[model samples]
Target: MNLRRLKYFVKIVDIGSLTQAAEVLHIAQPALSQQVATLEGELDQQLLIRTKRGVTPTEAGKILYAHARAILRQCEQAQLAVVNAGQALNGQVSIGLAPGTAASSLTMPLLQTVREQLPEVLVYLHENSGSSLNDKVMHGQLDMAVLYDRAPTAGITSTMLLKEELYLIGAGDSPGHNVDLADVAQMNLFLPRDYSAVRKRVDEAFSLRRLSARIIGEIESISTLTAAVASGMGVTVLPESAARVLVSSTNAWMSRITSPTLNLPLSLNVSSRLPLSPSAQAVKNILLSLLSKPTIEDRELMLVG
Candidate 1:
């Protein structure tokens, strides 16, 4: 049961000689033999066969050797992980998430994960527009951001997290059926401001179809837009994650946009000009891991790919 005795037993079996193993381990031969004897006594197994040509393991000893190696390797890995985390995980990490996108849903999960995995790190979250979040990342105000990709920014690097298809959301008691792009263009639409990535994509899609989108309102606040759509104010275009949330929480329905489907690129943006701090990098790793392993609730909501 003793880790030290198990280690000694492993060394003796590996070298095929107690004397040589003791010498290599910086322990006396008699003491090393006593450790092995104690281990065998505890396990009630004849572990070693001592012969004139040094020693070899019994069947029992071979099994113990395999298990001991695994246990020791796991212990070493635990120690190293703790040491590395302690060295660089203490600090504040600032992260941004654009509202109305799937990234916004990750705010609570990221917080919970960072709290559980890296207790020493402090997290500061900001909810803003995609363009605004990207600007903050570029200026080093934010360690990283989850937002839609914009035109190539000079000092920003983006890693695509997911590509979400845009849907037309409207107020309805039942789920709406899929609608064509031309049908979407005919509806009164409430959308984000012109500067937003979503707005730009919607505009381009409409232009390509030679159809004009009737923009009755420009609503930037997600809550306001959701309320407007749910109140029968007008229909709006949004990606799957946001549309799902709005439809589930309110009297709304989401229909997929067909006939030249519009897709939005959700990405993790960081400053290309500056390296991330250790604490920030640790937080980033946690974020990526959480995204890669989506929860059942997230899958049900169709929040992330």
Candidate 2:
């Protein structure tokens, strides 16, 4: 449990010999052995089994080792962060953006702000399906992500940003005022595969209306999808903001989804499983604060579209 004991344990396991660990640690073999024994006692578990060559950790020891490594690394980072707190914030931040409306809204502002405020910090931006982003966030691979507000997952935290209404996107010549969900069954639709969050919701909405979407094509890339819609391959349903951005890209128009209007709340997701680095937390704060203000107005999105 003690930090020093954990270090001793990990060193011994790494070097495969108590004598070598003591040599590397500049401590006596007897002292190192005592520290490990004390650690095992505190946990009431057998941590190591003596081997002819040196030592090997028990199953419990492996678990402890993994956690101990992370803890020690975090502690070291905390110290460095304090030392550099007065200076420019410098750390790597990996953020995930759900393609379409999310990119048009959050990506530029975040990049511009971080460049101005934390020039020393490095940012990695990834755009993918909402479900993909959520998976990465849930696994701690991403520091934060933007996803739809859905039923809670175990290790991810969500803060609802805006309840965006759905819209029907089609070629510019296509005309419709308020399209009903059930009517989608009659039109050829281009949608992401079933794994995608948007497709899942779209399918559910149709099912609720006792209708099935006439899906003519499956495209994962948002760019390809917009091009397909522009060429009049088929129509797709999108959030109001996303619809605006997509329509602006090509000759397209949008009609609000009505008749049991569907509204999906966009949320900012962060991993609750691990403590975010100081830089990441700072970025997270900026994100939530910015989103708490008014969402992108229809006029603002006109530029991106």
Candidate 3:
């Protein structure tokens, strides 16, 4: 397909008026109409429905519009890659980090790395729930995200970054140890809301054993949750990375949940349909490199592709 004709078609569909598209393209309306006609002829499909008010894409046109957008975006990225070749990448790349996992802790390191390596690239970090971040990534609102693998991956590509074993965090500072799932289930728990990916996993694991977790409250904030755990109000489940931080700072302890190992896989996700810009790809590479390295605090984390 002719890139120019596809561009004209997209603009017309966006504005819903060939006249306006011509005005924006600085071309005659007849020429713009001819371009669309030629595009429709080439594709052998009726792409639009024109009426007195405006034009709307036909079923085929809707499909074509989506593909055209992806194609155009890839073309733009290619142009940028060529232009910025052998030069430092400089652009804004937004990434989402789902809370309640080790992924959330990478915000500072990500910023520091970008500042040191890709100084010209500006990073925008979004810390949110996995489902929220997943939606943002699928919609192309974010360049990439680190989310739990439990989230739906229908419209995005997710590569497992690491697997973190869940730990039961509770009061008492006797070094960390193993805690059976049956025993841990009896404790009053404070976990994220049911909609959260971690919460769903916790619930599913309990359901499989025909036992229910005694959850006292839903806590999303780490500080509040840790405070509650430290005050002996209740226990909460967290990955080793987050549990380590809680135990180090608070009068609390973390025990690896066993008797049915529950591990949450953290994955790096990006849109499957849209291509990443050069700057975004560079930041993604940095994230992969940083997260892949082994650390003392997260020694048990199982790194994946």
lDDT tens digits by residue: candidate 3, 1-305: 87898889889988999888899999999988888888889999999999999999999998888778777778877888898899989978999987766766777888999999999999998888887887777655688988777655787899998888898988864434888889878888999998787788899899998888999999999888878898887899888888888888987878888878898888999989898998998899999998987675546544432
Summarize candidate 2's per-residue lDDT along 1-305 as a digit string, tens digits: 77888778878887889888999999999988899889999999999988888999899998787667657656756886888877877878888887764545767788888888778888888887777787677544678888765668766788887778878899855558887776767888998788766777788888888887899999877789898998887999887878888888888989887777877778888866567788888888877766666555744767677
In model 3, how large is the Cα lDDT of residue 183?
Answer: 88
Residue 94 local lDDT, model 3: 93
- Native-to-model Cα distance after best TM-score fit, residue 168 in candidate 1, in Å: 0.5
TM-score, structure 3 vs. true: 0.73
Q: Residue 36 deviation, candidate 2, in Å?
A: 18
Task: Report lDDT (CA) for all predictions.
Answer: 0.83, 0.79, 0.85
Candidate 3 lDDT score at position 83: 89
Worst 10 residues of 3 by lDDT: 296-305
- Report how far off residue 54 is in candidate 2 (Å): 26
In model 3, how large is the Cα lDDT of residue 172? 60
Task: Give the clashing pairs for model 2.
Answer: 248-305
Models 1 onward score TM values of 0.68, 0.72, 0.73
Which residue segments of model 3 deviate by more than 4 Å? 1-79, 82-86, 173-176, 298-305
